[model samples]
Target: MVSELCFSDLPAEAGQGWPRGGEMVGITLEVQALQSYSLDPHYAKGLHAWFLSQVEQTHPRLSAYLHDGESEKPFTLSRLMGPFREQGGRQVIPPNTPFQWSITGLNPEVVDWLWGWSQRLPAWLELRGSPLQIRGWKVLFPPRTYSQLLEQAPSSGSCSLSFVSPTSFRHRGHHLPLPVPKNLFHSYLRRWNDFSGLPIEVDLFLDWVDREVTIQRYRLESVKTTAGRQGSVTGFIGCIQLAASPRMPELLRQQVQALLQFAPYCGTGHKTTFGLGQTRLGWLAAERVSTPRASQEEQIAERIQELSTLFLSQRQRQGGSRAEKTAWLWATILARRESGESLEVIAKDLEMPYETVKTYAKLARRATKNYQSV
Candidate 1:
C-alpha cells in the first residue's frame, strides 16, 4: 500500500530554498520504505537532520541502513530514493509558497514504521530553528500497482524520456558531462541491476544496444551545483525519443517500461542526493508534446551533441590523450556557444582565454558544416 500526505501553511521562504546546501527548487523527502507518507519541507533549517536523528535514535538499524548500506560488517542500506512534487496539476507552486512531500516505499515493514512515525507528528514542525504549526495532513492512496504499471508499459522496444531535472552520469573516473544515448540507458540498466532483485544478465541488457537504439530530440542544460562555489551540473532536460532495434527481445521491452517508472523515483545519475537527475517518460512521435516547454538553451544543447560528435569524427584534429583533452574542451565550448552563452562568460567559467573560446567556437561551427556537407 502506498499513501501520500500533504502539508501546507509552511514558511514561504522555506519553499524558495530549504535545506540550504540542497540547492533545490521544490521540496522532496528521502525517506526509505514507508508504505506511503508525506513530509513537509526544509533541510537548511535542520529539520531533515533532526528527523533523521530521531530515526537514528528510535530505529538505529533502519536508520543506519538508510544512511549508508553495506552488504556485510556494518550493514547499511544504500538504495534510498525519495519522493518530490514541484507542480500540482497545471498550477506550479510559487517560490516561498508551501510545498508537499510524497513518501513511499515498497516494503510493508518500512511503510508500517513510517505510518507510525507520522501518527506521532508534533503540533509544530520546526524549520531553520523556528517552529511552525502544521496546517493539516490527510493520507492519500492513488491506484499504483504492478498491474497498473504493466498496462502503462510501452509495448514496443522504443521508449521516450523527459528529464524533468538535471540528469547526469559518471563514466570512467569522471562525471559524464553529456547525456549520450549509451550513458543514459546504461545508467538505467545499472540501477535496475542494483535494486530490481532480479536475476538479469548483463550481456542480455547490453545486447539491447546491438539492436541499435537511437536518441533524438533531446535538450540539455547546465545547472548550478550548491556543493561548491564554482561547481555546476550539465544535464539533459528535454524530450528524447529512443527507438530500439526490432531485434530487441520482448522481455527487454517489458523491462524498459519498468525502468522508465524506476527512473523518476530512483533518478538516473550521480549527485541524486542533492537532487541532480530526475526524469520521466516523454512524448512519443505520435503523441502531442506537452506544454511545459524546453528552454532555448536546452534545445541548443540537444543539437550540440550531434555537432560535437560530427566535429570530432572528421578532423581527429588532435590525437592521443592530449588530443582527446583538446577535443573535449572544444566540444564544451561549442555546446555553450550553441546555447547562446557569451564567450567571456564561458572563458571565465572554464578559466580559459575569451579569444581562445571564440576561435574554437568558430572552428567547431566550420567542422560541423564540413561534416554535414559531406
Candidate 2:
C-alpha cells in the first residue's frame, strides 16, 4: 500500500537541499499505521531499539558509542504524537492513522549519520510487530552549529519553552518533576558542554544562570511514566517562560538565550533518548491539557512507586544504593507479574537472570504480605 517512492529508489538529487554538515539537527518522520495495533505504555523503548538497530546496520561503531557512551547522549527521540484510543489498558491506533515521531542529533558525527541515514530511509518503521509506513519527513529544527546558536542568540529578551513530553531531572537518585531554573539550564548546559567542543566553565555559567535567570510564568502538570529498562519516572509536561535580569552582563545573557534555543535539539533533562524531555520553542497552551489515555501509564508507574516505597521501608539496609536498586527491581518484577506478564518475559525485559527475577518476585511477595499482616 506504500505508493510513495522509497528514499533509496529516488534520484540522488532528491536528498539535496536537506540540512547537512551541521553540528545539530532535528527531523520529524510522518508515518501511518498499516494495520490497527495495540501498544504498551512504554513503547518508546521499542522506538529507541529500532533507531539503534538502524544505526548498527550501517555504522556499527557509531551505534556502539551511542549505546554505550557514558557521556551525554548526542541524540533524543520523541514518542509518537497522534490520536489513539485506550483499550484494556493499552493504546490502540487504528489503521491508516498518522503519527509524527521526531529525532534530533547533537554532534557532527550524529548529524552526519542522520543525514546519510535519511537519504536511504526504510519504507517502514517496525514497532514491535506493527509496521508503520513512512509517509514523509521534514526538518523540525533548523540545523546549526553551537557557535552559530551562540552568535545568533537574541541580545536581550525572554524565552519560553514547551515540554511536549514528560520532562524530569534526576536528583540525588530520585526523579525531580519540577523544572527549577538551575536544573533546567544545567540539563541543557551538560549537553552543550559534551558535544559543542566549545566548553564553558560550568560553575561560572550555572552560577550566572541561577542568579540571573528567573521564571516569569509557568503552566505545568506532573505525570508519572515509565522510562528506560526498569524504573518509573515522575515528570512534568508543560511550558515555562524564563528571563535573565537586565542588569546581568550582556554576554552571559546571550549564553542563556543560546541554551534555550539548544533545548529543542538537545532536549531538557534525563532519559531524553527514551522519550522524556521532548521540548520545543514557544508557549504551547494546547499541550498543557491532559488526556485520559495518558494516565494509563501513570497508573502503572504509581503502583510501582508505591510498591517500591513499601519494600524500601521494610529493608533493614535501606541506606545505600544497593538496597534502593533491589527494592525497585523487586517492585518492578512484582508489578509486571501482577499485570499478567510472565516471569520469563519480565526477566528478558529487565535483563536480569531468570532465577534472580524469580527470587526477587518471591521476596517482594513476602515483604508485601508482612506489611499487610502488620
RMSD list, candidates in order:
12.7, 4.0
With candidate 1 superimposed using the best TM-score fit, by how many Å does residue 117's alpha carbon deviate from the native? 3.9
List the pairs of residues colliding in candidate 1. Answer: 12-96, 19-43, 19-44, 34-111, 35-111, 45-128, 65-77, 69-76, 69-77, 70-76
Number of clashes in model 2?
0
lDDT tens digits, residue span 1-374, model 1: 12233445443222222112210111233222112222211121143345556568668887776566642111111111222223321112232233333333333334444455554554544443334343333332221333344347767666667655555676663456566666766666665555444535767666676456677556545442221111234544556767766666777666666666555545566655443454556542312122122243334444444554565566545445555555566766776665555787667656677888789888877777776787
Off-target runs (Cα >4 Å) in candidate 2 are 1-16, 288-293
Task: Score candidate 1 by TM-score against the native.
Answer: 0.51
Q: Write the per-residue lDDT of candidate 2 for residues 20-73, one digit (tens) a residue.
A: 689999987878887788877668888998999999999999999998999999
Q: Candidate 2: worst 10 consecutive residues by lDDT?
A: 1-10
Candidates' C-alpha lDDT:
0.47, 0.84
TM for every model, in the order presented, reads 0.51, 0.93
- lDDT score, candidate 2, position 350: 83
lDDT of 1 at 252: 69
